[model samples]
Target chain A: MKRSICISALISTLVLIGLGTAAAEVVMIAHPSVPVDIVEAGMIRQIYMGQTTPWNDELAIAPVVIKAGPVRNEFLKTYIKKSSAQFSTFWKKAVFSGTGTPPAEQNTESKLIAYVAATPGAIGFIDHDTAAEGVKVLSIE
Target chain B: MTSAHKSTFMAVLAALLLGLAPQIGAQDIAIHGAMSQSFMQTSDNNYLVESEDGSFSIFEMVLNTTANIDAKTRIGAQIYGREFGHLGNNHMLVDWAFGDYRWRNWMGFRAGRIKFSLGLYNTTRDIDMVRNSILMPQSVYTEDFRNVSNAFHGFEIYGSVPVDRLGSFEYHASLGSAEVDEAYFLHDVFIKVLAAGGQIPPSLGFEANLDWAYSGSLYWNTPWEGLKIGGSFVTSDLYAEESFATPTATLDMSLDMDLKKLYVLSAEYMRDRWTFAAEFQRLFVDIVVPDVPVFVPDVGVVLMDIPADDRRGGYYGQATYRASDLLELGIYLSVFHPDWSQRKVGTAETEQKDTALTARFDLTDSWLMKVEYHIIDGTGDLPERLNPDPSQLVKSWSMIAVKSTFYF
Candidate 1:
C-alpha cells in the first residue's frame, strides 16, 4: 500500500508538470507599430470577434488566427469565451448573412508572427517560445 | 435576364475574382458555399407551399465571396438559388452585393443591395447550418412574405457604441426598395380580396411596381455575458395591377397596399452550450383603392372603392442545448394570429400554435444532418388560395422534415 501511494504521488506530480508546460505555450502579440502595451480581456474578445473595428489611433484593426487545435482552443476559451466550433459557426453566420467577415487564418506560428509584424494594424497570438523580434507582446490586464 | 445570361454573368464574376485573387493577399479573400436539400411530409393543409403529399422539393444553394480591399474597405457578394415547392422556382439570383467602409468603431456605411437587418435571426435565416432547426419560427419571420422581406436595394449606416462597463450597443438603419414579382405579390394580396367577397379568374395576370422601404434595429449587449436584447421596425408600400378575361369584357384592376408597420422585440441568453431566445412581433397591413371603374359581368361599369385593414402578430420562444461536440437538440413553441385586433371577417382571426422538436448531428466538420417534427394547430396563416375554404381545414395537423447540409 505504501509503495502504491508513493507511485501515485509521483504520477500526479509529472502530470501537473506536463500541464504547466502546455499552459505556458501561448501569448498575445501585435505589430510593433501598435501603440498599446496592454489590453483588457474584453477588448481582446471584441477585437477578435470583429465587434471592435478601429483602434484608438483611427486605424482599422486586423485580427489573425490559426486552425483549430489545443492551443487555439485554449486561446479562444480564455479570451473569446467560445469553442472553436462555435466561433466558426458565428463567423459562418456573419459571412453568409453579409453582416461581417472573419479574421484571416495562418498556417504556422512563424508565418502568423511574421504576418502580424509586417501588416499594419495586425494582431495575433503565437507560441510563447517562438522568436518574435519585430512584434509587441501585449500584456493581458 | 435569361438563364444563359445569368450563368455567363456568374461565371465571369467568378473568373474575375479568381484572377484577381493572387493580386489580393490570399488571407484577405474568403469563399464559402452551402447546400441543403430537404424532404417534408405534412398530414394535410399545404402550409408554405404545395406539400399535400410527402414532398422532396425544398432545395437551397448559395455561393459567397468576400475580399478585403484594405483595412477599412471590403467588398462582397452572394449568389443564391432555391426551389421551395413554388417560391423560388429554381432561379439563380444575386442575393446581395455591397461595399463597406468603416471610419471608426462608432460609425460605418454600406452601399449596394444589402441584407435587411432586423431581429436576431432575420439576417441568418437563410444559412441552414447556423440555425438549430430546419425551419425557422414562422410566428415572427413568416415564410409567406419571404421574398419581399429578404433584402433591399439601397444604403445603410451602422455602428457600435461601447457603454463603459455595461457592454455595448449596436444599431442599423436603412432606406431602400425591394424587387417584387407580380404573381407572388398578387397571390398574397388576393387572399384578402377573396375574403372580401371578390372573385378572381384562374388565368389572372399581374404586374407589380416597386416602392420604398425603411427599416432599422437596435440591440443592447448587457454587462452579463451572453445576454442581449433588441428591437426592430420596418415599413414599406405595395402596388400592383391585375387583368383577367371575362365572357363579355376584360377587367383591369389596380391595387395599392400599405405595409403600414412591423416591429419585433427580441431577447437571447447563451451560456456554455445552451441558448434561450424569444421574440414578439406586430404587423399592420392595409389596402387602399382610389376611384376606379369596375366591370361586373351582370352589372354595367361602375366606380367602386374597396379597402381593407388587418393587424397580425405572433410570438415564439426557443431553447437549444449542445449535447455533445457532434450533436445538438432544440425545442420551440410559437403562436401567431392573423388579426391581433380580431376585426377581420369569418375565421380570419384564427390563431395558430406550433410546438416543434429538432435534432442535428454533425457528421463531419463541413457536413450535418437535421430532423424536426412539428405539431401545429389552426390554419391561420396558410394562403387562402391553397386551402380555398377555411372550414375545410382540420383543426390539428403535424409535419416532419429532414434535411442535410454541407458547407465549406
Candidate 2:
C-alpha cells in the first residue's frame, strides 16, 4: 500500500508540473516611445476595446494581435476576460456599427513583437519567454 | 442566380472592395462583411414573408469598412442590401457613415448618418453572424419598423465615465431626422386595417412625413467583469395627410403624432461560456386627429373619425451557451403587446409569445450554419395586409428558419 501511494503521488506531481508548463505566461508589451512603463489592469480593457482616445492625445494606440494561438487566447481570457469567439464578435459589432475597427493581426508572435517594436504607438502581447529587446515591457497593476 | 440577388451581391462586393480591398493589407484599415440567405417556413399564414410553403425570400448582405486616422479620429461606413418579404426591394444603400472624433475618454463626437442605439442589438441587427440566433428578439427589434428606427442623419455625443471601483458609465445623446417612404409600415396599417375595416374613409391620396428625432441612453456597467444594466429612450414627431372627395369638394385632413415615451430597459450577463440577456420596451404614442365625417360601409352609417392608436411594446429573455468550439445552443422567450390598452384583448390578440430554440454550427473558420424553431402564440405582431383571411390567422402557430453565413 505504501509503494502504491508513493507512485500515485509521483504521478500527480508530474501531471501538475505538465499543466503548469502548458499555460503560457503572457506579458503586455508596447513600443519604447509610448512613454509608459506600467498599465493599469482596468485601462488595458479600454485600450483593447477602442474606447479611449489616443494615448497622450497624440500617439494613437495601435493594438496588434497574433492570428490564432494559445498565447492570444490566454491573454484574452486573462486580461480582456473574453473568449476568442466573444472577442471576434465584439469587434464585428463595433465594425458594423461604425464605431471602431479591429486590431491589426500578425500570423506569428515574433511578427507581432516586431510590429510593436517598430510602431511608435503600437501595443501588443506575447509570450514572456520571447526576446523583447526593442520594446517596453508593461507591468500590469 | 436571380438578377436581383446576383446584381445586389456583385454591387456590394464591388463597392466595398473598390474602396477598402486594395488596402486590405494596411494595418490601420479594417474590412469585414457577411451574407446570409434564410429559408423560413410557417405552419399557416406568412410570417415576415410568404413562409407558408417553405419560402426562401429573406436575404441580408452587408459589407463594412473602418479606418482609424490616428488615435483621436476614425471614419467608417457600411453598405447593406436587405430584403424582408416584399419590402426593401433589393436596394443597395449606405447603412451608416460617420466620422468620429474623441477628445477624451469621457467625451466624443460623431456626425453624418449615425445609427441610433435602440437597444442591445438594433445597431447590429443586419450583422447576422455575430449572434447565435438567426433573428433577434422581435419585442424590441421588430423588423417591420427597422426602416424608421434604424438611423438618422445628424450628430451625437457620447462618453464613458469610470467611478473608481463601482464600475463605469456609458451615455449617448443624439438628434436627427429619418426618411419616411410611402411604403413605411404605418401606411399599411392605415390603408389596410383601418380603411378596409371601415374606420377611415377611402383615400384618394396619402402622405406620411417625419420630423426631428432624438434619443438618449445611459448604461451602468457593474463592477462585475461582464454584467451591465441600462435603459434607453427615444422620441420623434410624425404626421399623416389624407385626401378625400365628398359630393361638395375635396378635403385634406392631417393627423399629428408623436412617437414619444419610447423606453427600453436592458440587462446582460456573461459568465464563462454562457450568456444571459433580457430587455423590456414600451412605445407610447400621442396622436391628435380631428373628427371628420366619413361614410362607413361596415356599420352602414356616417360617423366621426377615430384614430387607431394604442400603446405598444414587449420584453424578451434569452440564454446562450457555447457547448463546444464547433457548436452553440440558445433559447429565447419573447413577448410583445401590440395594443397595451386591452382594446383588442377579446380576439386573443392582446400579446404574442415566441419560444425559440436555436443551434449553431461552425462549419469552417469563415462559414457557419444555424437552425432555429419558434412556437409562437398570438397574432399581435402579424401583418394584417398579408393575411386577409380571418379564419387562417390562427392564434397558435410555429415556424422553422435555417440560414448560412460567411464572414471575414
Candidate 3:
C-alpha cells in the first residue's frame, strides 16, 4: 500500500509540473510614441473592444493580438474579460456590421514586438520573458 | 441577373479571392470574407418564398476591406451578394463604403453609404457567424423592408463617453436617404399584402422615392459586470408613384408614406457561459393616398381615396448558453402585434408568437453549422407572398432551418 501511494503521489506531481509549464506570464507593450506607460484594466478592455478609439486626444488606439495560444487566453481573461472564442465572435460582429475591425495579429513573439515598437499608437502583449526593445511596457492596474 | 450568370460571377470572384489571400499580410490593410448557405422549410405557408416545399435558395457572401489611411483616418468598403429567395436574387451590390475620422475617444465622423444603427442586432443581421440563430427575429427585422432599413447614403456622428463609476455611454446620430426599387416595395410588400384575396395585376406597380431620413441610438454599459441597456429611434418619409390598370380603367396616383417613428428598447446581461437578452420595439407608419379620378363603367369619373395607418410592435426574450467550446444552445420567445388597437381586420386580432430553439456547432476555427426550429402560434407577421390569401393562413405552424458558414 505504501508503494502504491508513493507512485500515485509521483504521478500527481508530474501532472502539476506539466500544467505549471503550460501557463504563461503576459506583459502588455506599446509603441514608445504612445503617450501612456500604464493603463487601467478597464481602459485596456475598452481599447481592445473598439469602444475607445483614441488616447490622450492625439494617439489613435490600435490593438494587436496573437492568433491563439495560452498567452492570448491569459491576456483575454485578464484584460478583455472574455474567452478567445467570445473575443473572436465580438470582433466578427463588429467587422461585419461596419462598426469596427479586429486587431492585427502576429504569429511570433518577435513579430509582435517589432510591430508594437514600430507602429505608433499600437499596443500588444507577449510572453514576459520575450526580449523587447524600442517599446514601452505598460503596467496594467 | 440570372442564376447562371450569378453562379459564373461568384466562381470568378471566389477565384480572385483565392489569388488575393496571400497579399493580405500587413497591419495597415486587412481583408475579410464570409459565406453562408441555408436551407429552410415552413409548414402550410411560404415565409419569404414557397418554403413549404423546403428550399435551398438562401445564400450570402461578403468581401470587405479596411485600410488605415493614416493614424486618424480609415476607409473601408464591403461587396455583398445574397440570394434570399425572391429578394436578393443572387445580386451583388455594394453593401457599405465609408470614410471614418476620429478626433478623440469622444468624437468621430463617418460619411458614405452607412449602415443604420437600429436595435442591438440590426447592424449585424446579415452576418451569420455572429448570431446563434439561422434567422433573426422577424417582427422587428422584417425581411421585406430591409431595402429601406438596412443602410442609407449619408453621414453620421458617433462617439463614446467614459464615466468614472459607471461603465460608459455610446451614441450614434445619423441623417441620410435611401433609393428603393419598385420591386422591393410594390412587388414584394404592397402587391402581395394589399391585394386582399387576389394577386395584383402584373401591370400595377409603384416607385418608392425616399426624401430624407434620420436615426439615432443611445447605449449604456452599466457598472454590472456584463450588462448593457440601450434605445434607438428611426424615421423617414417615402414618396411613391403608382400606376395601375383595371379591366375598365387606368389610374395614376401619387402617395406619401411617412414612417412616423420606430423605436426600440434593448437590454442584455452576460455572465460566464450564459447570455440573456430582451428587446421591445414599436413602429408607426402613416400612408396618405391622394384622391385620384378613375373611369368606371357606370360612373364617368370616380374619385378613389385610400388611406392607411399601421401600429406595429414586438418584443422578444432570449437565453443562450455555451455548452462547450464547440457547441452552443439558445432559446427565445418572440411576440408581435401587427395592429394592437384594431377590432375589425379578421376574426381575431393579428398577433404572432414564436418559440424557437437553436443549436450551433463550431466545426472549426473558420467554419460553423447551425440548426433552428420555430413553433409559431399566429400568422400576423407572415409575408403575403407566402400566403396569397390571408384567410388560408393557419393559426399554428412550424419551421425548420439549417445553415453552414465559412469565414476568414
Q: What overall lDDT goes with each candidate model?
A: 0.78, 0.78, 0.77
User: In candidate 1, what are the lDDT values of residues B92-138, reduced to their tens digit?
Assistant: 67677777887677789998778788789887788898878998998
Of the pair 2 and 3, which is ahead by DockQ? Answer: 2
Clashing pairs for predicted structure model 3, backbone only: none
Those runs of model 1 whose alpha carbons end farther than 4 Å from true positions after fitting are A1-26, A31-35, A54-60, A106-121, A126-136, B1-27, B182-186, B191-200, B203-206, B243-251, B289-303, B343-349
Across residues B371-406, which tens digit of lDDT does each residue of candidate 2 receive? Answer: 999999888777766665656788899999999998
Pitting candidate 1 against candidate 3, the one with the higher DockQ is 3
Q: Model 3, range B249-352, lDDT digits (tens) per residue?
A: 66565767899998989998877667888999888888766674545788786666666666888889999877665777899998888885642344323877
Q: Assess every candidate by TM-score.
A: 0.85, 0.86, 0.85
Tell me the lDDT of model 3 at B173.
97
Off by over 4 Å in 3: A1-25, A53-60, A108-111, A127-134, B1-27, B182-189, B192-199, B203-206, B242-254, B291-301, B342-349
lDDT of residue B359 for candidate 3: 91
Model 2 chain B lowest lDDT segment of ten: B1-10
Question: What DockQ, on C-alphas, does every prediction get?
Answer: 0.23, 0.33, 0.24
The RMSD (Cα, Å) of candidate 1 is 7.0
Candidate 1's DockQ is 0.23
